[model samples]
Target: MKFTSEEDTYSWAVEFGKSLQPGDKVAMFGNLGAGKTVISRGVCKGLGFEGSVCSPTYTILHEYPNNPPIFHFDLYRLEGGADLYEVGLDPDYLSQGISLIEWPERLEGNDPGLTHIIRIEILNETEREITLEKI
Candidate 1:
C-alpha cells in the first residue's frame, strides 16, 4: 500500500496489527527513516499499549507493559544469528509474547517462525510503500 505520510503508514499498521495473535512474530524491513518504528508504534497501540514505543536500536529490545506484552527488537547492531542468540533471541524468549523485529536481514538463517513480513519502501521524503506478506 502507498502511504503519503507517516501517520498513514501508522494507521495502516494499527489496523493490520489488530488481527495479530499472541504468538505472532513480525519481520519488518526498511531503511533508515522508512517508518518501521512508526508502524511498530502503531502495532503497539493496536495491541492496547498506550505508552511511548521507541526504536530498540541501541537498547536491542523493548518490552511493552501490555497484557501478553510486545517484544520489540532491533537487530541493526547485531552481526548475525549468533549475536541475536546472545541477546536472548531464542525461541524460548520469543515465545513469551508477540515479537516485532527490525532489520531482520541480520537474522538471515534464524527464522523465528514469522507470521507476517512487512517491507516499507521509501519512495520519497514523505512517501512510503508498505508491503505485507503473510507467512
Candidate 2:
C-alpha cells in the first residue's frame, strides 16, 4: 500500500484491523521513524481501545483493556527470545488477545503461527510503502 501521509497510514491500519481475530498475531517490520507506532495506534483504535496507544519500548509490553483486548510488544531492548518469558509473554497471554509485535526479529525462535507480517518501507520523505503479508 502507498501511504502519502501519516493519516493515510493510520487509516489503512484501521481497515486492516477490521480483519483481525482474537489470538491473531501480527509481526511488524520497519526502521525507526517508519510510523510503526502510528499504525499500531490505529489498530488499537479499530480494536476499541479508547486511550492513547504508545510504543512499549521501555515496558516491553502494553495491554489495552478492550472488548477483544490488544497486546502491543516492543522487543527493542531484549537480547533475544529467551527474554520473552521474563516479560510474561507466554502462550496463554498471546492466545487470549490480539498481539502486535514490533522488532519481531528479536524473537529468536518464537513463532506462534503469525497471522500477518506488516512491513513498512520509507519510499520518500513523505511517502511510505506498507506491505501486509498474510500467513
Candidate 3:
C-alpha cells in the first residue's frame, strides 16, 4: 500500500499488528530513511507496549516486554550469518516472541515459513510504498 504520510504508514502498521500472533516473524526490507522504524513503533503501540521504540542499529536487538514480548532486531550492521547465530537468533527465539527483523536480506536461510515480509520503498521525504507479502 502507498502511504502519503507517516500517519498513514503507522495506521497500516497498526492494522497489521492486529493480526500478529506470538512467534510471528516479520522481516522488513528497505533502505535507509525508509520509515521502517516508524512502522515498528506503530506495532509497539498496537501491541500495547508503553516503552520507547527505536531502531536497534548499534545494539543489534531490543527486547520489549508486552504480554508476549517483542523481539526487534536490526541486522544492518551484521557481518555475516555467523553473527546472527552468535547472537542466539536461531529458531528458538522465534518460539519465544514476535520477531521483527530489519535488513533481513543478510539472513542465511530459506522461507522460514509462515513469515510476513514487508517491503518499503521511499516515494518521497514523507511518503512510502509498503508491500506486505505473506510466505
Q: What TM-score against the true fold does each predicted structure earn? A: 0.94, 0.93, 0.91
Worst 10 residues of 3 by lDDT: 79-88
lDDT of each: 0.87, 0.87, 0.82
Task: Go through the candidates in order and give the C-alpha RMSD of each one to the true structure.
Answer: 1.2, 1.3, 1.7
- Ten-residue segment with the worst summed lDDT in candidate 2? 80-89
Q: Can you write out model 1's per-residue Cα lDDT over 20-51, one digit (the tens) per residue? A: 88888999999988998999999998888899
lDDT of 3: 0.82
Show the lowest summed lDDT stretch of 10 residues, model 1. Answer: 80-89
lDDT of 1 at 29: 95
In the range 1-135, model 3's lDDT, one tens digit per residue, is: 889999999888977887888888899999998988988988878887889999999998899998778989888887655355664476776667787888887666634343799999998888798999987
Model 1: number of clashes? Answer: 0
What TM-score does prediction 1 earn? 0.94
